[model samples]
Target: MSLYSRKAARLQLNLRKVAVKGGLAIGAAQAANAALQAAFIVILARLLSPADFGLTAMVFPIVFFVTMLQEGGLTSAVIQRETISHRELSSLFWINAAIGLALALLLCAGAPLVATFYHEPRVEGLTMASGGLVLLGALAVQHLALLNRNMHYGRMAFIDVTAAFVGFIVAIAVAAAYHSYWAIWLRGFVTIAMTFVLAWLLSGWTPGRLAPVSQIRDLIGFGGNMTAFSLCNYASRNLDNVLIGKFSGEVSLGLYDRAYRIVTLPLLLINAPLNRIITPVLSRTRDQEERYRNAFLSTLQMGLLVTVPLMSFIAGNSKGVILLLLGPDWIDAAPICAWLSVATLLQLAGNPMGWLYISQGRSRDLMLAGVANSMFICLAFVAGLPWGALGVAKAYAFCAFLSTPLLFWWATRRGPVSLRNLVGAISPFALVAGCCLVVVHLLQRSRPDTGLLFLMELLTASYATMVLTLSVTRTGRSCLAQAWSVAVSGFSMMQMRKRSSYG
Candidate 1:
């Protein structure tokens, strides 16, 4: 083969290796995170009232939105840049720190306003306590980005899982002692602080003298757009909670919040990690259009392979899952969970649209799309607010379902990825997932008893049916073969490393 051919072949092999390693590391981390989260949710749900969770949830969006500013898209900018200077990074770091401190102060000052708007005095304290997360997050944003830029997912995973575990322990302890919403607030504070400390340790980069302001303007410019996009996106996603809390009261908001979390748990476990990995990988291959497209589609396929069935099962067994995980007190969240499941499923299906925009340097498109998305979502929230939390859930899900096709078309219209490619890639998984949902739904009806044994049986049947269907079809077989190869590759790599260490 020619030198170019040889280099191309090597790049392909490296991509596969990275994919395998990243997937395994992220999978392990997500599993641990999910388990910890499940424990936290179960324990907290039983210990605290829905009002407690709802009050805390009301403050999260505001805090999270401010935290996004601390990040300022600078990390993404770092990851996407072909090359970055120490000075540029230092400049970004200081800027992030400044934003973080400012936002923290602002949040603290605005706490009373938030409480007033919610008509709940507790929100003031909750908002103030959570304000520090922005500064803490600022301390780590760039470090985490650098880790991602270098593809150090294993270390990143370790930091994330450890932080989550520690935070959960603290939160549980506090809840047991105080039996108040402060426990949940403390969890957020602890998790962010721990993550910041660990990220600095693992990233191994220290900021030196700052770069000249003019030198890093391009990086800042890129990040500014990204931050703008995040602001819009954050508003759209959280408007539901804000509106629901204002109109429906803490109990209703709590039900909606818990239901949303349960439904999106699969996405948090799967799509989130995939997105983190894919961004850097795609950035590296941006010049190789075919390779870039293939990498994204492959990642999307694998992500859906896991997420689809899990979501379908959740949708089919929402009541049982809620009953088992959150206990009988949270049974009211079941219907909302079911609706949010479909919304999350559609949301995940369209999420790759983001990978294309970022990897291909389409921040402008991303920002514009964010604006449009926020508008649509806000309208839906307003329309549903009159009916309370359930109304909001139904409206949000309906909007998401309605927007999926439009989002795909818009995202792909200017990128290397096409609407046709996306549809073709997801069609098989969608069809099979639909079939599995139907089967699971029928079985669930037949076993209407929500006992542990019956729920277990339903879950087992759903997964089994999905696997059988996949094994029986050509596309399904291909997906299974691809997954098997990645798994085997990951296993072998682990073995080699172990032997080397011993030797």
Candidate 2:
């Protein structure tokens, strides 16, 4: 029933082909983007200060909160609709544009208030400069959504990476030249410009005119629940930023934000590519109950398998990861990174549930689940306020993990991916991580000058390698083989392109 089975049937075969090609393209694009971003972060952190990073961090969450209004799932609505009209697309585009303009003005007006909230007068100007990205982002929404609906990811990949590269270059240059928060603002401006360029280049089709009132109304209703769910999800994820800025100060917020970035980076890497590829695919087979069931389970299986080891390794080697990746200045982030890494890993278990809901047209359930999750998280944050950043992270992670079963129960209706499947998927990495912890402790017998940092790295690397090695079993071997094939094919294509150009 699933479009993705081990068997080499025709439909499965074709789906695999599409997934292989699309995933590889998006994955490579993301890798380039991540590498560029990492370079920017590293260089910028050195050139700039934690205070600078924190200031940008302080401005971003408020900006993001406003920007989320522009995205209200109109793109996904476009994608999920089996037959979209020119009128519908055109109408959505205009609506998003108007929303973007309003949000831009709103952001400008709120800058003073935002600055007041953080007690940082500097934030007012920074926000005013950065607020334009919302309108820029809004402008491209319908165009980008149309591309996703068509599953034109190869084009999408090119557009995204090119824009990101431009943004990074602008930021780095501005940072080097001015050595001011202007670099932060420039990143947004350049990103928006690049997006506009790419949107125009990739989206060959253009809007004609707005749809009729009735047509627009229908699409809005369809997208409403998805929008509501997204809003709640955004707030829940961003609670820490708001709390840190309010209680701990900008510098503290900066530290926590950097740590949060390190923890969630892997998830972003996974989610961006997988979500792009999976959602459309899921939408295609939504009506076929058996197909939906299988696709959903396969996705969950892969998500768990990948998420666990990464989280385990990070949690086990938090100290070294922080020092090596972020530099010695970020030593304060080690514990926060460790706990939040665990939290994100736990969060991955529920990742596919929303997709399943959307595919099944259970939008109300999606919104309800999101609201519940967000409310729970907010309450947890309030309770943990006294303990500071680490306490907040600890509390957040606990709440996220606790919500997994509830999410699963909602998604499955007590069907496949039962408690046993969940445990089985998670247990391997957890067990390995525990073993790595023991080894780390043993190596820390003398507690060398570097302390647990060096020892933890060795322990984690060894454990992760072993976990991966054991994955050579029948079921695991197949997935590994497929992944390997995808990687090889992608690299080969790149090499071929290079050779042809040179010759």
In model 1, the runs with Cα more than 4 Å from the true position are: 471-473
lDDT of 1 by residue, 1-503 (tens): 99997998898888778878888898899999988888888889999999998989889889878888889988878999999988888888888888889988999999999988888888898788766787899988889999999899999999989999889999999999989899998888898899999999999999888988888888888898899999999988898988888888889989999888888788889888998899999998888878888888888888887788788888888998999989999989999998888888888888778898889888888898888988998999899888888888889889998888888988899766788988877777777678878987999888688888887787777777777878866777887888777778889999998999999
* Number of the top lDDT candidate: 1
Lowest lDDT sum, 10 consecutive residues, model 2, at: 443-452
TM-score of 1: 0.97
Off by over 4 Å in 2: 1-11, 414-503
What TM-score quantifies how close candidate 2 is to the native fold? 0.88
Quantify all predictions' global Cα lDDT against the true fold: 0.87, 0.74
User: Per-residue CA lDDT of candidate 2, range 382-465, in tens?
Assistant: 777688888888898898878877877776664333555555544554554455555544554445435355645565565566
